[model samples]
Target: MTILCVRFQLPSAHETAFPELLGLLEEFTPVVEALPPDGALADLRGAERYFGRGAVELASVIRVRALALHGVDCVIGAGPGPMLARVAQRAARPGVTCAVSAGEARDFLAGKPVAALPGVGAATARTLCEYGLDTLGRVAAAPLSTLQRLVGAKAGRELHEKANGVDRGRVVPNAVSRSLAAERRFPRDELDPVRHRRALLSAGEELGARLRAVEKVCRTLTLTVRYADRSSTTRGRTLGEPTAHSADLTRTAYSLYEALGLQRARVRAIALRAEGLGPADRASHQLTFDPADEKARRIEEVADRARAKFGPRAVMPGGLAA
Candidate 1:
């Protein structure tokens, strides 16, 4: 099975607009591993034969399509597995796709820095370097017992496994992020408490809308408030019932925000996260007598329909684009 890891190299001009580019990638393969707002890893194992092209040829086609459709360049690494694919992509500069045959993964990784090995963070690298393990080849050749003594049993075993290019990590299918998040920063910090509340509400609304669209329900809400001094506090609430209802999400988010007590504070941004997602169809919504709840959901359905037809911004809740 061949996996292709494509790193979409977003230019400075479109840095924050990478999700738009990911939408383009989704056209090629539904098994896209979103690296979120930047790059993606695609399992193109079965696609090659279906497309009647070799992996290299398909990579070229993808590069051409990305350039033409999104006006973006990418570095694609093609290999028989995820680790090799990721390493191959790292070897390619922007606008190129490099394919490594399965047989060459070891040679390709051998002379690279130990730091190039995944999971070898700075502290580990420093420790390894002190022991003359500057390169992957050296690490691979080292006594596993010695490495354990240096970096502990677990880290050492993992390092020995990866340095020898023995990664067995599967390309996970149906992997969804544990949390759904929406965040917005003001062009300038604001001191109004009402505006901050509005920002939290809007973020909540966005999160809820996304959950509904994706057919998921979340069991908890977390709100993060960022202040002018760049410090922030996060508060969370467990929902009484799992829901994708915008009003419920908004109320929870607002309560979490208010709990931070940012009166007369310089607020820079607000972030809301919905956590512990499950299938929306499986979730049970508690009955409520509040007429306002029904009204808000009715309005949300209309907004969703409008956005589906006209575009995402056509019916955004207040404070999102502010």
Candidate 2:
């Protein structure tokens, strides 16, 4: 095993401390790449020789340190490459290190569903499965030309390579992002659409205020809805332009919620995450001629000033004023 995929089981309250967790991985390998919100990819090629320990052993140490020092637990997967490592990690539970040896890579992946492979979205998986190529083994055995004809040339080649355990992907060294998240939990399982929409509006308002306060703009917004059954659905939308505006955030959130087509879902919580963040000065807003739009922005600026002088709740959206 040369690569390790580590995913932390972090509490929502500690989401901001994700960078610190990335630093912890760096102690073991300088090749740690931060996967924001709660995960990381660490290449242990140098560390294995330096520490005289296998990747799985080092993963155990990482798990222990994260729990003992930060009171957080992590699941890890170790493999010969990044793609295999990521696939292994999904099958691992907390406190476990699911390691796939080089010799066992093909056998390990053969039984998994096509969707289990990274980059194979629901639509693609469905298309492949319809033709009896539901498993990695089936995909690997299919004729290259046949596969290409089915999913197009480029996607076909990549799919075949992954199925055969050929991962040319590398762990890129990346810094932690300025991701911001906010969540609201209902007192009881909420089945009301009106209440859910209100919660989303409140979350958007909070996210916008926080981004403006930090002088940052986000390029995308992600919505996660947790249901009473403990299952969840998540979707992300990229904005037309980077923004720290409440209206844009709310509109994106609403679009995502509507796409879910939830019919009386018992929702326990709603969370919104703003990602791809950058300096507000470096971002641009589209030029508009609408007087109403310009007026709204002016009013928003005044409200921001009031909130800064008084308190966070001093100026709030009408939906959340109560």
Candidate 3:
């Protein structure tokens, strides 16, 4: 079975949005590993039979769907594993699919730059190139002891194995989701915490709905604020308990925002991530004595139902940004 990694070079416009692209991959297969904005890795072991086509055909459908729905073209690469597939996509043009069969995974990787190997950054690549190990083929052919002396024992060993096209990883289909995150950037920078908080709430609400849909609950949440100056801050907290409740997630997100004490930070965008996910059925909910809390939850459920039928804006919380 081959793993196919689909790399979508989203236009600069939609580079920061994740949810829409995630939804698109969910249509092809639920076992998608989202790489955010640009790419995704999908385990296509079972999809071949289900889709009645080869991996290439499956890639074609995904590419066409993305272009039609979002105006983004996808370049897909299929190989025996994630590393090979990802590298293959990098060699492809937009809207094209490249397949590297298991037999050729090694040969295809050989001549590529050593930096093409994952985790080999510029510094590491330059260090390797200094030793005349510019291409992956050279790294793979070099003695393991020599590589260790040049880079280090740990990084050298890993690079040698990867350059030789060795990846022992398997697609983890049922691993408990680690987190749910969403972010949006404006066409123009805005410096209003109120607006920022609204976007945060919107993201939390969407994440909560997704958690419910997936039958997962989260026990922690994180908020990241990106400023126009390329600076950012991230804050996180454990929740009272695991929950897929939108209202609870929003409250936690709001608290995180308040803690930032932005005061007058020029914020460009905001992101919310619900982490530590587990089966919703296994989560224990705390009983609430506050009438307002109960009332708000009930209203939230009603809003969810209305949104389900009439669209997301059918109901909105007070103070929502226009």
Candidate 4:
């Protein structure tokens, strides 16, 4: 086992501490991919040799260090590759690390449900189960041609390869993203969709203003909703165009919230992160013939100027008004 997939037991109140946990992992290995809101995947091939320890041993130290330094405890899974590591993680609990050695890779993957494989969505799992290929063992035994016929040529080939416990995936090193974040916490658990939208609107406006002030444009928006039970759901969307526009940010935030289909959710807080930042001047604005859109942009420019000259509170979207 060379890779480690770690899931941190981070509560919503401590959400901002995720980066520090990622940094701790980086001390062990450079190839740490942040699976945000609370987890990461770290490739530890070099670390094993350097630390004179196995992946599982290193995991114990990591767990202790995380708890000691950050007060964060994590469950870990170690395997030959990212896929196996992720599977091992599901079987692992806090204070323990599940390690899948190379010799047991095939047997370990064999009895798993098709849905256990990464990237195999519910629809794909249903389709595979319908064909009596309900488990990875069956999928591994199936002919490549048959799997291809059932799914697509490329997807079927991948499925067959992964079912046999081959590690085609590698851990990508995490790079720090230049991003802006804003969060709004409700006084109590909120279930109303209108209030949820209001929180999104508030966060978007803050992010957009910060980006514009810094002369940056962001190509992606991430939304994180913290629930009353301390769990959170995170979703990210690539924008149609890079933008520092408040309206565009708010609109995208609204769409992401709608896609969650959690109109009656007991939400505690909403946070928005604008990422993939770059020079605003290099970004192109989508031109539209609609006069309403044109008017909105013109008004937005004026509003930006007003906020700059006066204060952020000088202007606000009607929905965000107190």
Q: Best lDDT goes to which candidate?
A: 2
- Worst 10-residue lDDT window, candidate 4: 44-53
**Tens-digit per-residue lDDT, 1-322, candidate 1:** 3677788878788876566555444333435577765667776643443343566777787788778867878888888777778788888876666777766767778899988876678999999999899998898899999999999999899888877777676565332445667777888998987778787777777677667665678899988888899998888999999998888898888777777766688889988878777778998877687798778778988987766556556776656666
Candidate 3 per-residue C-alpha lDDT over 50-136 given as tens digits, one digit per residue, 9 for 90 to 100: 334677887888788788878877788887788888888888877668888777777888989988886889999999899899999
Query: Comparing candidate 1 with candidate 2, which one achieves the higher TM-score?
Result: 2
TM-scores for the candidates: 0.52, 0.54, 0.53, 0.55
How far in Å is the alpha carbon of 307 misplaced in model 3? 36
Q: How do the candidates rank by lDDT, highest first?
A: 2, 4, 3, 1
lDDT of each candidate versus the true structure = 0.75, 0.86, 0.76, 0.85
Misplaced by over 4 Å in model 2 are 177-322
Question: What would you estimate as the lDDT of candidate 3?
Answer: 0.76
Tens-place lDDT digits, model 4, residues 1-322 = 7899999999888888888888777556556788877889988765654344778999999999899988889999999999999999998999989999877888999999999999899999999999999999999999999999989999999999999988789987663645657789999999998899998888888777767665678899999999999999999999999998888899999998989998579999999888787878999987889899889878877877777666666788888787
Candidate 4 RMSD to the real structure: 16.2
- Candidate with best TM-score: 4
Clashes, model 1: 0
Clashing pairs in 4: none
Candidate 2 local lDDT, 1-322, one digit each (tens): 9999999999998887688888677555546678777999998865564345779998999899898879899999999989999999999988889999878888899999999998999999999999999999999989999889989999999999999888889987685544667788999999999999999998898778767765678999999999999999999998999998998899999999999999999999999988887778999888899898898889889987777666667777888877
Cand. 1 Cα-lDDT: 0.75
Stretches > 4 Å off in candidate 4:
177-322
Query: What is the Å distance of residue 312 in model 4 from its true position?
Result: 54
